[model samples]
Target: MTDLHFLPGCRIEEITRPDANSLHICAEARRRSGRCPDCGEPSDAVHSRTVRHPADLPCLGREVRLELWLRRLYCRNPACSRRTFVERLPGLIAPRAQRTDRLATAHGRVGVFLGGEAGARMLTQIGMPTSGDTVLRLVRRLPLPRRPAPQVLGVDDWARRKGRTYGTILVDLERHRVVDVLPDRSAATLADWLRGHRGIRTIARDRSTEYARGIGLGAPQAVQVADRWHLLLNLRQMVERWLAGVHGRLRRLPPTVGQPAGPARRTGAFPRSQGERVASADSRERKKALYEEVRRRHAASEPLLTISQRMRLARGTVRKYAQAESFPERAVQAPAHSILDPYLAHLEARLAAGCENARALWRELRDIGFPGTSMQVRRWLGQRRSAPAKTTPRRYREAQPAPVPPDAHAGAPALPSPRQLALYLTRPRDGLTNEERSAIGRLERDPDAAAVAVLVRRFADLVRGSCIGGNAVVRAPIATFKRWLIDAQNSSVSAVATFAAGLQQDAAAVKAALTTPWSSGQTEGQVNKLKLLKRQTFGRAKFDLLRRRVLLAA
Candidate 1:
């Protein structure tokens, strides 16, 4: 209806909605006296009057423009700088700003959250039109907050470029806010920062030796706690290494192509399906023809490149074919198991029964406990719908599908990868999938695997306390960790022993982690946020801008 109010010492003259998307307000400052910024002297003498047009916050989805009339007051005192000055609006628009303080704050906040380009686009759509560069300028102009030294600090490193460069971020653990970001994760840089803020009582960090050394140099009195997650991660890595050492024994080879699938023997070749066999035969026939041609051309003194170009094959392949005494059969690798294995037969049966609509078939399969999405079903349906007339004909309409080999991988499941098995060991028993549960069951049957599992579970309990024998759980974790360390060191598994030795090197931090509630987990989450901001700028931001964004903003 009207321009209700403005600055404390200003009066509104007129309010007009110029268009459907714009609001213009005319206001004037009615100050009794103004102060000269140069000499801090009160002046009532009017040198000249001036009109200021500044942008305000949008009103009712329309852009707001403010035209404020103010006086250019002259300094009265001779002691003050004898010059005219534009009167200031202390709580509204700044002396030289083109927008209200509140509006600039809104732009700056958006810029900090979304960064330049995205913030500018967002501001334009929201009726505060501004350029990306302007938003960035506003963000950089924002003053950094004065934060006191944290009582408990969480320190961690984030890669500026992974495996090449790294930076450090310190967070106030109690307040859960980023305190500052450093250029590098070096001990000296962190030590300098820590020395400056001497009030830190505890420091939570990862098991990096650099950080340990830094903490030692910076604040020796501060209690250093190793992150429990890192401790667990190190154990998993050790488990993987042990698995790697014995991988040959753990891995079962596939049966040779021509041999009937039986107990896994040291077969040199892989199994092939009937279709793969057909495909391989056709491929070999074509290669044999090509090989003959290559040999004939080679005998005629043709260049390898010429032969390759003529045959549309690689020179190496042509040379290889030409060099062979006979056309060698291409080795076939075992076909990987697909997600459609369980539903393949049922899908074939349904297709034979004349259900052709992929969408309907997908819904039917979904009702019968199918886990795959409809897109896979649709694609498979497209292939199967045409495969009937091609691969399968009326002559083989009544023929049954081939039976799976009794003693093959179908009967005895394949072993999981070493990294996968290590994760399975680290994961909670109750949270495992049914297949993972069965896999672990089979793994425990092995004496080596059984011993490793026992040690891993014990170490896990020491770090993350477990309920044992109905409420008689571990209370003194540091003591438990010490005993576990001795047991792990004496274990038959060399990898486990190696892991235990590493814990002994940083026994204080390890013990502190087991006993204390603090961790660098929160700091890790902040690093992820930092990464998001860095990537949003397409990795072009330097350390200074990145530091400002990470520290000054949330």
Candidate 2:
């Protein structure tokens, strides 16, 4: 018979199909003598024989299984500990492994790239029958290669369960690969990891105090650099706080020409009914009482937890009230149900088409199953018509004065919200839209807002490394930043003063952030990747599996 050499050093004896999806390839080892695994001595003395079946890679679009006949050989060396050992094929498979090395490698790659159930489906489509659990096991079994100590490091924490538990990921900033993952974000855990791996020159991190302390304790020689992005983000947050404090001032400012009034202003603070006014007054009194109590407790040096327990409020609510400089106004929620909702779109379409007759619109709605009365439609149409055409440019002829609803009046002049004001203050002038520019102009009308705006622009220029000039650009120096921070601290803006204090606390890191270009931006990107990997496991995977996937896959 012609010998069919299927696998290396093995001959195929027979082939059979146990099922339509699978093919069994029976084979036997060609060598008669086997080596003892422990003693490494050749032995022809066969004590027993057995047949081992292991899965192999798919062949010709069918799942392949190998049935190999193996021998149990007796150890010939008298001094050897083992009396007998199983014959092993080192290149074909590992000891007691269920699959060949080549097949395991393919599964491992699929597991690393696609992850578990998705990988199993992909492998099944390619004629490899395996479960999601098996794919995960293969991935977890892969060995991690030893990496050299990183010269520059980036550290950040990722949530295993957001707001509850987190893990720290340390990356070699130079190579941009994750070096290790610690089980917790605690100072002790991170410090331990850092101590194990030395030779770090610089550590880039966020403004996390725990990480800062850990780095200081573990590697005092390494320079700590604060991330620039976090610094800019802190600036934006401070600006928002400052705006929040002066939001009432923003409302008092007159609206600019061509600026469309917001919904709040359009509904200009209509005179509330007696009952509505009574209810609002009651709500305000209750909130003010709570705010005062929180502030009093905070002034007495009571911690947030003690205040929360004493007041019978959640800690988060207690913290908010304590931190707030003034009692927060109750946010006006929009009416949930409106009679005009169903017909408003049609009315706008008609108005856009120059159809302004309320009676005609009422008749049209009645034909379309509108159950509302003509008077209700007329009142709504009157409000829309009376609203100043800030957005639309078309001219309209005066029509009959439709009766206004008791609840409707000219809204307060439209003004930008605090958030929009903050964006206008921080973003580049070139990026602002015409409306935003107009809003900025309106804000600058207030002397206080204008002073704050100027400081914001100067700080932004210093951070960006350039300043606007009369047809010429100029470089901003670090000295300018130092001077600006001093000015900000002395300024009347409480948010800016608080921000300046923080900069002073970490003066060295902040200065390094400005002078040196190194940053934790790469660490942020790796965190995004880590989020993707965490999601791939459907959030059920433990740390060991997650660590292997991140390190080995990289």
Candidate 3:
């Protein structure tokens, strides 16, 4: 049966199952002639024969063993240097190999997706048993894909070990697949890689100086587009820094003359009882004391790390304490309605009418949709009874109390964190909720915040492809960006001014980012995927094996 397609050019003389888990096939090369090793001459005289048992792909849950007969042919040419040469069956198996090419290919595929240990376990479970080392060897031996250099390339860095070692990843934007992974993130390495791929017409990357210098050194003619995501991220961080300096603007400010309070101050919950109010007040005091202690230790020039260890607090909390110039006060919020609110008047009326039985009042209210238990009614009455009696004289109480100005901070909302305010400033206005919109309105009370928001929105819109090129030189938005940059450069907020200066330094890349449509988004996505593949090996795989897996697995 020479029809066993896997062993092409070979004939099967006999096939039999030796055990339940395996099958054996007696096979030999069908070729009768072969070329001499040293001289280019064909030979048909068989000089010797040898037997080999090579393993192949599993067949129907059984291991396949082939009894192959390889023949040695005698060189008939008198001028040949070699006496004899073995016939090469390249289509079937490799020289001196213990397994067939088909089996190796299958194992390589398994190794590609699941690294060594996992692949070995999977192969054994699937009845094609093989060791992890063999699987890894097969994967490493695989040939990488061959393709021409891409015109549009994306480049970004990935952390080999975050905040420590890093590497660069290149992607073909058109194919959305990784092209290569460099061991380190450096200008020389990227320059070398880019020089080799001269076909690149556009290179999309982040606003990193190393990458920029590398591109200039290697592919000066290629256009460099800064990543839009990085641009907006930088903007948000600037906004956060500005907010940090002006923390008062992010909170609900005391009402000014004729200015009304915004809806952001609306409360979300209420104290369930008198005891709850007391408990909340006590908790606030405890928090105040702890904050004071943290700030006190920090002001003494103690390292925040030591403070965190002594206090059993997070390092971030310690840093926040050290950074605050004053104790951040929480704003007051109105109490929410409770289930007992509707029944309160009825219970009071009964108590005043000499019907002081709390259980009877609770039962009466239960018929009118009051879902609370009698214990709640009892607690309310007991609290009222336990309150200290007022000692004011009845005659003096009738006199009008001195006129008091309204509490300006009443019903104020708790201040949003700097990061939260930054999100509101950078995110689209259309996506904002009613509370966020109100917060924005409240924040605008500070003229500086209003001016900063205008600049932030303009920058965000430009980066998001909604450029406002009104009265620009060529309606190309480049002029509009320049004008906005000037406005930010002169801004009172140092954070925004600093960021604007950075943009001016990288003017070319920033401008190219606005004009070009390609970005480093694909490159960033590939880096994230690389993290997954790296973690698959528990971070133990060397760079060579990881690179091979990344290339071959693709």
Candidate 4:
């Protein structure tokens, strides 16, 4: 209600509410004697019509705003040779700021946290008028002190657009915050960041050749520990890649179409599914049809190999079919009969001897002429256990399991296998419950599950076989797993074959990691968080802001 208030060194002259939500105030500057801020001259002539500002009280339980207006008079001193100057205002604004001090403070704080565009949106929500660019300017204008280099540093690379532009970020691991961002994840840039730190003793980073070189150059004495999460992630990716290679080979074969479902047979070759078998058959049929045209030419007296070369069919495939009894009479040899035949006898002997032991049988086969390693053997055995057992004799029945039933446990397919369970257990399962795990376990163990049950049992055996400090020895189960993966008929064998090559490539590291407590748990969590952030940002992210948010949030 009152316009003026008395103070020791300053006076507030007037106050008025221009609108219900805003206040308007006018005040006079009453400085006794001071040099002009603009002209730097002592004792201004009456610099006419000046308004002073005091820090305003909080408004609507939110922010404070202030305004100041002042004029400069022409300096009347000829010898001093100075123009008119405005009164100096310290603790309020720099030389030229359009908004009041209070508003700028609000923008700075909000921009730093919610970012420019987001801050603008939030400010509107809170009844303040602001723009995204204004908030961004506030961020740029915020005063920050030059910081010293951190001792324990972490380095990582981020892609602006994957495979296009990449940037490197340095974090003070102790502070758990990003300190700086480099133009690229190159040895030169990273090395420069490290060179700035005189006291750096250790750096934690991923296994990047560039980063390693940079660290070596920047801080030769710093010990680099490969980030454990990255280690696990690289390992997992490597394994997945190996599996994909086998998948490529399998794709070349046609899918098995309308093939009779039965207990899967044991073949030393990689197992293919009914779908895969159908695919393989389709491919062969297509090839066969093409070959028929070539064969017609051959029958018409074109050279045998010449027909094959023209059609692009293997000469061997043409020769075998050409020599067959008849087109309808001749059977296509199973994709991998050679691998299966030698081991089939051993499987029968084990089952007959009441051994019921996959590992023993796998070992027996390995001792004979099995081409695949023990892991391959174990995968094959696991598939056999998980697959549906045949009512027919072991010699002829194929190992295809029944379809999954409805009303199965939540987050589990109707026909879940132990291999799937093992896969799920390795990663986070947000939707799966304990009941789901048990249900899957039950499915894996069910006699109806066949080779799938074998898979579950093999997983259990591997878990049990984990030992302390000795050789981390490969037990009979591993050999069985390998055998199952190479087997053609076992349903679970497909998954095993896919995972085998990767496991073999880094078999040593993987075995050690599995045997030890190290895992990809943290890395997977980070990947999930990254996906969420990527979705939230929606491709409009600035590298600086994204990097800041990740480092700070972590």
lDDT of 4 by residue, 1-554 (tens): 33222222234566666666656555454566547554466675665765544344345543334445555655655655566666655544445665556567777677666766777898766645579888767666666545667777767766666768877766666555456667688998888877777798766666576787888898888766555455434434433332222322222222222333333354223555678768866886876676467557767888868877887877755654454323321121223344555566567667655654455666777778777655555555554553433334775356554332222334222332222333433344455555445433443343433353354344434433443343344555445545643451344444444444544543433344334332333333444454454445565767655554444334
Candidate lDDT scores, in order, read 0.79, 0.77, 0.78, 0.53
Give per-residue CA lDDT, model 2, range 1-554, as digits (tens): 11332476677888888999878999887777888788899998989888889998887788989998878889999999999987887778778988988799899888987899999999999988789999999998788878888989999899999989999988888898989888899888888888887889889998888998999889888889888778777777777666665655565566466665332212323334556767877988998898899899899999999999988998867866776656655434324455557666788789888876778889999999888888767666555664543443454334333333322224322456566678788888999866678778878888878888988877776666632223232324567878998898998877678888988888777776776667888888888888898999888889998988888866
Q: lDDT of model 4 at residue 209? A: 68
Error of 4 at 130 (Å): 2.1
**Predicted candidate 4: what Cα RMSD to the true structure?**
17.9
Candidate number with greatest lDDT: 1
TM-score per prediction, in order, is 0.74, 0.77, 0.75, 0.50
How many clashes would you count in candidate 4?
59
**Which residue pairs collide in model 2, if any?**
261-414, 265-411, 265-412, 266-411, 267-411, 268-411, 268-412
Cα deviation of 120 in candidate 2 (Å)? 3.6
Question: Which regions in candidate 2 have their CA more than 4 angstroms from the true location?
Answer: 1-6, 46-48, 81-83, 114-118, 257-305, 308-326, 330-355, 358-382, 385-413, 466-476
User: Cα miss at 372, model 2 (Å)?
Assistant: 20
- Over 1-554, each residue of candidate 1 has an lDDT whose tens digit, in order, gives 44443555688888898888989989888888899988888889999999989998888888999999999988877876558888888878887899998889889888888988999998999899999889888888888888777999999999999978999999998898999999899999999989999878899999999999999999999999899889889888878767654644544343222223332222112334579868866987888898889989999999999999988998757856765545543322224555666777778889999887787888988998888898767756654464443444687666444444322353444566667888998887888866567657666767877899989988876776622233232458867877888998998877788888989999999877876778888999999999988987888877887888888776
Candidate order by lDDT, highest to lowest? 1, 3, 2, 4
Q: Distance from true position, residue 314, model 1, in Å?
A: 28
Looking at candidate 1, what is the lDDT of residue 453? 93
* lDDT of model 1, residue 55: 96
Candidate 1 has a TM-score of 0.74
- Give the poorly placed runs of model 3, Cα more than 4 Å off: 1-5, 36-41, 75-85, 255-409, 466-474
Local accuracy of candidate 3 as per-residue lDDT tens digits, 369-444? 8898987787566534423225436764454432221222454444466777789988989998666676677777
Clashing pairs in 1: none
